[model samples]
Target: MNSHQPDLRAAVRRLGRRHFLTLTAAAAALAFATDLPAARAASVPELDARKIAENPFTLGVASGDPLPESVLLWTRLAPRPLEPDSGLPDKRVVVTWELAHDETFLRIVRGGTATAHPEFDHTLHVEVTGLDPGRPYYYRFRTGTWESPTGRTRTAPAPGTATSRLKLAAVACQAYHHGYFTPYKHLAGEDLDVVFHLGDYLYEYAVDSAGGSRAYTDRVLPAHFNREAMTLADYRLRYALYKSDPDLIAAHAAHPFAVTWDDHETENNYAGDTPENSVPPEEFLLRRAGAYRAYWENQPLRAPQQPKGPDMRLYRRLQFGQLAQFDILDTRQYRSEQAHGDGWQKARPEAEAPSRTITGETQERWLLDGWKDSSATWNVVPQQVTFAQRRDKPTADFKLSMDAWDGYPASRQRILDGAEAAGIKNLMVLDGDAHVGYGFDLKKDFQDPASRTIGTEISTTSVASGRDGADKPANWDDLTQANPHLKYYNGRRGYTVITLGTDRARVDFKTVSGVTKPGGTLTTAASFVTEAGRPGLTPA
Candidate 1:
């Protein structure tokens, strides 16, 4: 925890007292909803006898979606995770939780009870509030005599105050079958407020069928993961398998997370109502709904983000005092189908049509409105897909990925224009999903370098997607030289760390030497800084 203890009374004033009261009421209601597990034991003797003998916290504990006055704590009850139904009797279980000022529970502040219903994969999310802002809190959950791991989470600073700095790590695309989560173990030790998982939290396809750059080298996945995740039970089992990773659990316990999904969470390169495979629209929707429900059950998101059928509103804003504000966007949900069905496509007339949208009209309006109204010093857009334009060939003809922002030129232009019109000078865009690191300046017109530099974009690589990736991939030099705005590129596995100061924002491209094996070393491959007013990347 940062030791600079600001005045709690002043912090309360910044976080309005009325809002504090409302949060207290919400927490109380969550506590009142569940009856004690011991109280129900006598009535359900059979279920009690089959009580979890082994540790149900194998998947570990996580905390996320922090606010000035509230935060969410999450844990799933899984005694035998590899089993079909998590090896538990089909019954609702009462779970107890506590938030404290210190790691030890001696100085407890708030405690509550929640029901982990089997309908929701026995996952629990407790929304807690009325704590002092910009400070660390320790939280843990308990079911009967079994207890979860203690997780450390920090709340956001009071909304409108001028905090000095904010630290965050951007991570994505961890394919469990490819390699080990060694990078996440390194991330767990960093001093960070949050980990923005840009997407691909867990891949949905089979280990062998999901053709990546390389084969599985770290370890063999459980037998259940050999198949694709199609049903609700399959999705739940996949999440359990990923959560069982120790390094990933460590990262979750170390800090709160704000996450959004990419295509692989459900199916490869899926658009709004269209799946990558040629499944019928009706059947694909059912699969999508199942994936969405499983994602919600595992993450630490609040009730508002819960899915209603196939529709779930995930784009939202998180503020860190007056220093920084993050607008987390969901690009996979309401996007138009990939041009030419997911490959390099010529920039044609239809591709540039105004009707073609990557972010649906509603989300586009919401993002533009957020830019227009945001008052923070540094505004960040944490989203999936590469925001910059990358040309694959060196010829006069432009070739780019139809699945990325390049495919929707008109929509991208609108966002850049909105930022410029709203006078958002310190705009920063962070993304993941390429399985490669990209450091570049966001040009108003990607094709023309003479155009204005509107912002800086730092796209982090995968945690472990391309196993032991080559340092110099095919056409790497040609592509970097062709696109002069691209400051740095790395094919190795890693995540990017961003440190936001009042005057400047520094981005460190942290890479692990290897991920195919355990205990790889961490190294800073490159570092770039963007000054407060200037929106271009400079080698730091």
Candidate 2:
């Protein structure tokens, strides 16, 4: 065989791949149009808009899990949102969805009908399929002449295909009583591909009728929201209240979001069935079931992600062509109870026990195995807490957050060792729940300044949890002087925008001046970038 002939064959194979991806959407569209009938096969009860007291699409629309050929679209029907039953009679409703290449939807590629059962709180999950690789599409839902706001979503690049750039926003920690969610308004306007909500989607706290620090002078919240979420109905109502925010609704409508939960989703600092308070294991599991059930109903997740009792397999992988692979983990569900009562404590022997695991043993194995043959340029982990060691004092007697990865040093060691064994490159861990933006160089040994750099971790600040924070806390100098691996830090309320490319990944800490009232000006508090091959963070 001629050597030049082999080169020509390689070029032809590349061209063939491009051809397939280009035709995937158009071909699927034609096949769907010819295969299925447009009308619903079975008859259902009709829901007239005039009969219903209010607009059903009050929570707005959202899409998630952007696969190459399909995406999960979500919306709930709630006319009177705060009511336990959402003011709807116990009945099923049919929702029609349309997806098009243009905003006007003149050239719709896919259209379908989905039933919203009262069993699932009238929530709709339309897994629209047959789409081109990395292509943008506009979609909306319709029921009884009521139309939901149009949402824009894009699919990932075709499998094994090389992509140029991917933009993402990491967000978390919203406390309604603390302040308003101003960050989301700015986030909705940004040009981004996806959003990663690491955790703390809603705080299990009480909100007064006036809406906490928001102090809504125009309206009053329902009395039901005045207590922490405990029952399934309470949890569902909490989601409705959070989703009612226009800024948050707009953010979800703008981009697809991939989510994973932390402690606050169920209970503060909860580890599996173990509750933070002195609650019975069996009783606490019941609360967990409620939280998980409500979480699945509200989010744009598929059937497989739904909870079975208190167990939910939320640890899964999402890929963006050959550019990045995100391993979304559930650290709060399958973790060892935090040592030293789950607070900042001196290094303890119990945390170093080999049996101690934060990702659980099964999930740890899965995460390590996924990295073995990863074709993506960046192996990312969108998880709950900080992956790097955050010590209060520089000395050996320093204290670490037991609620974070520092309390699971043995588990952290296993993950780091596994990455090294798998020959993984460009390891990036995205974190939420810190209430402050942080950039750190993940090291094999935090005690040693010359230790090998394992990866880079960026912990994004809260949307409204910490209230209006200062640029530097009182212990800023002490913290900077202590942890040498800590490259950047910002005490504010905002999110992090990550721009990933083949060569490097850059994270811009986007902060707002304040969140107490509303309309805080967004600004970049700091910027950091890590090279593709190298694992340490550097100021960009």
Candidate 3:
């Protein structure tokens, strides 16, 4: 063979075995589609198969942020609805959406159609704008003869529209195998303007990690997912399974969700390139790229969140008129490793080591700048994990999880100091990931009892993670007693409903009996209020 021809053959071989397999699969698919159902079999009428198969919007329709003139409409067109788990073939469906002033959609304001391609799981995100702000609207989608359920949504108040009040429900940590999402069902019923999911919307762990434990008994999941999610298909299945939950669906249909992801969205204790399982560098990048792509495909986020390789830009700002400005941060992607031995091991006292960061340099600056420049009365830091420093102090034997902000003490203090220095009063940090609810004064230092409180931090418990329950250890009581800065602590599974106004913001901790039980009741377990400029939490 000629040298050039030999090189061409080598090049083809270098395309990798997986690529070759994919080509074979594609060819097989084409052959199968052509051979079967050129027309339907006599057993099933060709017309019926043709007719039924035409309807594409099988997963249902959802709309977020219903402005007076525009709304964000989402739908996944499933050509094979019954075989929901199956990937879409080479097919395209046209999704027609309409927004109306009323639920009946009698007065349609905006109407358009977009093509949903199989590559995107036939999902379409139509962010329609040009409507009035701070108004409720109803929307739905149509594909062929099928129609999705109409969803209700409301837009943000026009920028700087000095609103008197706004209600937002904050929640996070929904482990699929842990329990039912009845808490979401309750939240869907609540009268709220917006919902904020701090992080851990889905766990990356396999089913067996949960084991056949207390709450995992009745849990149902996709047949696969025995390993950590690494492929786009794996992520899609994970999301599909989560979205199938009635409560989760209800909540999405009920209110717009402002979301961020914690470690579990990609991998446990994941910090940029370092994953908990120690994925090899190149392999980890590939996995991250896949995970990020799938996340963008499923979430109702704006286009900016579309991932580029392994990175998805999740940190952004959401405004609720002049009442509040929510600064959502991605804490997992830019952080140092957790301290070993329960995270109590202090970093080496050297400048470089103690200076290890959680938010990285750029994100830290962004957060601080956003806080400083905000004009809203309530500056809400919608972040993942507890902001207060965990004391593993005199007893070096005791250690806290290094995965959290506590592990980066210097960085945490810098954030607190930045807010204080910027004169950004009324700072409220809403966090999740501890699987336990906590109320703390965001102080310069938690180790020092006399540290000045700069703001308030409310760490909401998980929605369905098994770590949350009514049971509390006696040691928890001892910890609270020792730490006066910690006002309250609970291991209940629930969320926080926050109501913000000009003078004060109230956070109501809504607790659920248990996540394993479907349709569990929710009640306000505790409530805290922060007066404007007070910068500290007061009992509501």
Please report the candidate that would top TM-score against the real structure: 2
lDDT of 2 at 49: 41
lDDT of 1 by residue, 87-172 (tens): 67767778889999999988999998887766666799899989889999999998877989999999999988889889999999
Where in model 2 is the C-alpha error above 4 Å? 1-50
Candidate 3 residue lDDT tens string, 1-540 = 000001212322455435423434323322232222123233322122235445554455565533334556777765443243333454455667888899888899899987665556667889988988998878888766678777778888888798999998889999877887878888888898888888888887775533323244454444565566666567766776677667887888888777788878787777767766654554554566567766777777777776655666788888777888888888887787665633445544431265678888899899888877888888888899887865543354545546777677778878878888877888889999888888888776666768777788889889888644874644586657656788878888888888988998887888887776565778888888988877677888
**Pairwise lDDT winner, candidates 2 and 3:** 2
Model 3 is weakest, by summed lDDT over 10 consecutive residues, at: 1-10
TM-score-better candidate, 2 vs 3? 2
lDDT of 2: 0.84
Model 2: per-residue lDDT, tens digit, 365-477? 99999999788899999999988888886666778899899999999999999998998878999998889888999887888989988899999999999898878876677
Alpha-carbon RMSD, each predicted model: 10.3, 13.4, 7.7
Ranking, TM-score, top scorer first: 2, 1, 3
Pairs of residues at least 3 apart in sequence or in different chains that clash in candidate 2: none
